[model samples]
Target: MILHFLGSRGCIDQRSSRHWRHSAMMITQGRERILVDCGEDWLDELDSLRPDAVILTHAHPDHTGGLERGAPCPVWATPGCWQSLDALPVAERRLLHPGQPTAVAALQLTPCPLAHSVRAPAVGLLLDEGAHRIFYSPDVAELSDPATTLRDVSLYIGDGASFDASLLRVENGNLCGHAPIPSQLDWCAAACVKRALFTHCGEEIVSGSHEEMNKRLENLGKERGIEAALAFDGLEVKF
Candidate 1:
């Protein structure tokens, strides 16, 4: 399995030097490309990658930004996600019913819930075969899935929007609900994750030096004794 990230920016796409990251990801697992998310401006990239399945974790605009780019092959999302995505006029809106096994480009995937700040319950996908498993999660407060769904996962990706709890609560202050990076790590460790990744970062993250953030995450990983890395746009991972 190979993971190709076309864009990794979290929410909004503020095109500055620090935040060039888009918000698209493509996974080439079974000869076909399985696209995870596609922001609006990612049409150019999608035009190149004719994906077999476009999986949607949530109905947020940054995640569904480029839905019209494709003729709409197989778009997977939770039932709530479907309710939220009612505005989009797509060819197919396959509802991701929990615990149901579905095919995504030759690989079987299961949908699990990830409690998020949005009106709809967010999702965390487990794409696996008889042996290998890859947990793909974005835009959530923490890992809110049932334990059986995430046992001994090989790769884990999650939302890490802010640097700390203080910033999470204080970011623009009036902005109600959001989770931070440190809190996200807390959830990952409790989940007993293997080879974890922190993505869906806020704009402040891009502005601050990744080196500094990397240092902190490195220390956290050492303390927890687990594998973790910061996710970036255009990053390619071969499993």
Candidate 2:
């Protein structure tokens, strides 16, 4: 399977050439095209994208605002996500259960619950074809079951909200917000995942010097014995 990053910026006002658009990813295998998220930046570009289906991680505006006008094909999301999008004019809505693998053409997607937002709860996806496995979660605070979710994963695409400082907060006794890059790298190392790429970039990445940040990420990965880098718009990876 081939993965393409459509956007990399987080829900921040700051924008750079590398992280200009909101977070989104397009996965393709053979003739099947599946869009991961359709943020506001892609509201008017759906026709051009022409995806066979759209699978959402959550109902955050930065992730789902583009579907305000409705989608061209079937939309698959969790029950919580569908509830938040109930008022939208979606033509087809498919329910996705966490931990249950769903087949979309040649790929299998398993949604794993994540500790992110209380209002708009999110899930990280475990994408598996027969030969390759990838874990994608652009906005994440904590994973409920990292061992099970990350098992045999070859690549991990995680949040880039912060590089080292934790953005975690306790709201109504639940953890919310993004996890730092260092913490995510630890997860990758523990899971034995060799390659990792971070997206959903926050101010630290979008506003800071790219050269310094890249060096920091490289050094951090080396310490943990993993390969890591930052993801950018239009970046493509095959696995």
Candidate 3:
């Protein structure tokens, strides 16, 4: 599986005036594409790829901007996410309830409920193809033990949105409806995740730099005896 970050910031999409990079994420699940969140003006991101499906964990504007465009495709969302989209006229919101398994692009999808400000039933998706299982939860508030949720997986791509983001609110420069960095680390201790990636970053992160976040995570891991990785816009991983 290949995942490309089309937009990684939490609140808005901005271009690096100097570097000129975008903040959208594009995940190519074995050639077929699945867009995680469509925040900001991403006309190019949507029109460019013939996405097989669009998955929305919640209905935050930054997470569902593309739905406003009304792309002629199936939009898979939690019942809350569907409600969030129902506000839109063109969006044909389909149901993606937590704890239920479904199929998309030849991949089996299992959604796990998560905690967040919205309390709108955030989900952790477990994408499987026979033997490979990829557990993904991009935005969350706090994580419980692994037994009832993400316990074992080949890869865990979650709301590592930023190093210290979950602490602050979105309007106050936080990651909005998600957990703080330390909370996630505590949660990972129970899950045997081969690899962990951070996405849904904030604008401050762009200025602080991914390298700084990596160093912080490395230090945190060493201090706590665990490892985690920062999710970049163009990061790719193989299972």
Candidate 4:
């Protein structure tokens, strides 16, 4: 499996050379290419990626705005996501159910519901490529099924909205905003996930000193018995 982070910036005013664009990713396996998330920053330029299909994590403008112009390939999204994307001119729309594995590009993708914006509702994905397994959620407040969803996963890519401080809020009985990096690391540790990468960077991540953040993340990872790192645009991971 091969993965590329097309964008890593979160919904914040901050933008740097390393964390400029909103979160988006491209996964390629065999001859198939799947693009995930198409934030507002990408709205004017969707033709460059040339994806065979597009998969959405949620309907937030930061994750779905780029599709306003329609896509060249099929688009897959959860029912909730479709509710927000219904007006978009995507060429094709397919349903992907939570807890149900959907086949795409010879890989199995299982959506795991998460605690996030009630209006936009989000889902973390479990990508299984037979030889490799990964769970990725660029924005999450809490995961519904951590144990089952993260079991034996090789890599865990998650929200980077905050590092040590809590940026979460409870609204109308649903958790919203991003969980701190420390909290997510604990989840990874409990699930026995050995490596983790964070994207969708918030102000702290985009403005903080990379050296200091790396040290802090390294220390946190050491305590959790896992390897933790931040992801930037154009970053690639292959396994």
> Which pairs in model 4 have colliding backbones?
none
Instruction: Report each candidate's C-alpha RMSD, comma-separated, in the order given.
Output: 3.6, 1.0, 3.9, 1.1
Per-residue lDDT tens digits of candidate 3, residues 1-239?
Answer: 66666555565354343213323455676668877666545554577767777777677666677667676577787877676566565555577778889976655788877666453456777777556776777777665556346665656666655566445354433244667666666666566454566666655555666577678876765554566766666566655
Residue 232 of model 3 has an lDDT of: 69
Residue 58, model 1: Cα distance from true site in angstroms: 0.7
What is the alpha-carbon lDDT of model 4 when measured against the actual structure? 0.89
Q: Each prediction's Cα lDDT score?
A: 0.69, 0.91, 0.63, 0.89
Candidate 2 lDDT: 0.91
Report the lDDT tens digits of candidate 2 across residue range 1-239: 88999999999999999998999999998889999999988888988999999999999989998998999999999999888888778989998998898986566889989999999989999998787789999999998667667889999999999987679999999999998998888888878888899999999899988888888898999999988999999899986
In candidate 3, how many Å is residue 68 off? 0.7
For the record, the alpha-carbon RMSD of candidate 3 to the native fold, in angstroms, is 3.9
Worst 10 residues of 4 by lDDT: 99-108
Give the TM-scores of the predictions, in the order they appear. 0.85, 0.97, 0.83, 0.97
Candidate ordering by TM-score (highest first): 2, 4, 1, 3
| Per-residue lDDT of model 1, residues 67-155, tens digit only | 75454477878788878776676777677787788886676888876656456556778878556787777676555443455687767
